[model samples]
Target: MNTLEQLRAGALSGARRLTLRADLRELPEEVYTLADSLEELDLSGNALDDLPADLPRLHRLRVIFCSNNRFARLPEVLGRCKSLEMVGFKANHISDVPAAALPPRLRWLILTDNRIEALPDELGRRARLQKVALAGNRLTALPATMAGCERLELLRISANQFEGLPDWLLTLPRLTWLAHGGNPFSAAQEAEALDNAPMPRVNWADLQVQALLGEGASGHIHRAARADGTAVALKVFKGEVTSDGLPGTELAACLQAGAHPHLIPATGRLSGHPGGADGLLMPLIPPRFRTLAGPPSLASCTRDVYDPALQMAPGAALRLATGMADALAHLHARALTHGDFYAHNMLHDGDGEGRLGDFGAASFLASVPPQQAARLKALDVRALGCLLEELGPRCAQHADAVQVLADACLAAAVDTRPAAHDVAQRLRRLALPCG
Candidate 1:
């Protein structure tokens, strides 16, 4: 068979998968002949709107990619594909989805950059459904039936009309991840009484200020302790503001998002300080120098600077990378962008584990101006690339593992760079091989 004939022959046969992307606006009838055995298909970046009715005959089909299409509605035939597990319809024009058009086995659904205003109540009935990405849509409210999705773990409903989070949503046992603050329906209470109220005085009797840890452009950090002897970090704001107004407020918001196992936790906000202004209370971190002055390098940390025994080793580096990936995943899942993501902003928890810190530049994705968002994401990618460069030589013995991470960091296109969740998955996979 010639090249075209060979491709056509494969489509006609009982192939388990197919990925045809050569100026095909519509699926040829010949493609349906293998429906029974086809388990995966990729017809993305095409002009197809609806699927052939025979597509439901693909009983073994598990995944489908129909993104970047012109579909106004979901193809009803998908409901018959009982084995369908995932569907990627991002960057489409889909405005509505009939509950009956979805398969019960569907688990991961990606409908980003669509015009969907609402979902049917039956959407929450899918027992196995776990992750749902609905960013860049027009959702006004989530169906209350969503509470029935007991297995749902990650949800991204940012840029919607939610004024407040659904009460039932907050109670879901498996709903550990959420990012929906942009919607009008999800508006949180503002920082009230700030203007009339006097600045809160720091309870010095309840806390002890220690030595200065470091100084940033906007603030100075000090190691501090509570009256009960609990250790914490104190960040006193500088009197002058940079081009951005009130950097302290932004920092406070990032900290209020709370601490992840892989993120340094901010304890509380403190006012009335030695600098004559408000400051932040955070967890105290032992001083550990990172390779920021030059290309990514891991120099031997001296005992006087920080406990040499606590320094990160090869195994520890792998673990720290994995943990940091998860932390980034959490932030990304919530549509929160960490403007700066270098090693300088990450803190080791004394046992090789690490947590993301310094959210002074962090912002909700939708809240950031479009041009600024692009710049921030690009900067983050550069930082990640630098990190990979640092890890590459140290992990030279595991070339393939190192390359995988480096490649993710160095993806040519900003949009093509792996998301935090994808990075975490890759890191986990690399860890197994490196070990």
Candidate 2:
């Protein structure tokens, strides 16, 4: 939220990253002064409809975010920036995406909540592409050319018009995280999910909201007390389409997931919100609980990050893995895929006890054909494999056994990957020996 006055005053001369949110109608001319050092730019929350044709003058720029703006099309100048790799234009009216608008080195592209109906074949030509967010758009089909992006690991195509998924999408060797719910093909199943969940309505009047606990991409969480004086965590949706999908779609998926020991126990559905916002009620996490790991970095692209010095006993490592495996199995039994299955979503105490949270990227599996569902399941297993690999050497002992299971989850043949139930069962067996 830096003011334009500071930028224009040359106060940020040596800044490598600049963010200005002053309702700018166009790129500030002062930005060019930092062309030699600027590496990132954030011009979100403005009224901008376009970027200058010579925006590439920022030769050192590598990332740019222009979300919540008025662009009707992606700026073609973006492709000309030789160092640019990350581009975000979420929540715009963008429809046409010219082939010339995709940079050759593009790795991460965020075009969520737009009106795009088709993607240029050139999108596939970016060999470095890894993460793509295209949810909340009008896309009916994806270009077949995208099959060549061998390094792609994460994709979000939910809440779009897609009638079905393509075969190549399932076989992507590196694609471990995905979401495709709330589309034409899955709308009926989404409705079924909303209707079939046995959730209780928790009236907003029954609770007293307290201090904010945390905020995420789609909502704010607050600590609250129920009518019975019991503490609970209340998550109120922002009621907007996020890069992952609609908040309402995510809320439905969580209700459908029900309750499990390894999952954050969602006790009731939030109702009678004065603001008309969708939300959920769950047991409040204690202060001792914290995220097991951090989300991906610009360099990691799709992998969660753990402390380099992180070390655990053989039993602790096995216990953590087993609990997560149990959560994954529970989710799959209900035909749900936790699309963003990373350590960052796993909350744990100092010990091995943990629960998987965050349904923002979860997708229903009931709608996809059996073959496609199988592939998606394999994708889930691959995510588990990555987690296992991430924690492999961190275990003081039994690292070999952990990697053995990881290799099985990461098997190249989709159909050959072990089922979620089997993975959980195997982990339970592995933990018994270490204990």
Worst 10 residues of 1 by lDDT: 295-304
> In TM-score terms, which candidate is top?
2
- TM-score of candidate 1 relative to the true fold: 0.50
Q: Where does candidate 1 stray beyond 4 Å?
A: 1-5, 11-14, 185-435
Q: What C-alpha lDDT, on a 0 to 100 scale, does residue 353 get in candidate 2?
A: 79
Residues 387-422, model 2: lDDT tens digits: 889776655566797898899999877778898889
Question: What's the C-alpha lDDT at position 311 in model 1?
Answer: 43
Task: Write one digit per residue (lDDT tens) for candidate 1, span 81-194.
Answer: 888988878878999799877888888787877888989888888888777778668887888888888766556675555554555664454443344434553233113222
Q: TM-score of each candidate?
A: 0.50, 0.96
Model 1 scores what on Cα lDDT?
0.63
Candidate 2 residues lying further than 4 Å off, grouped into runs, are 308-314
Give the Å error, residue 131, model 1.
Answer: 0.9
lDDT of each: 0.63, 0.88
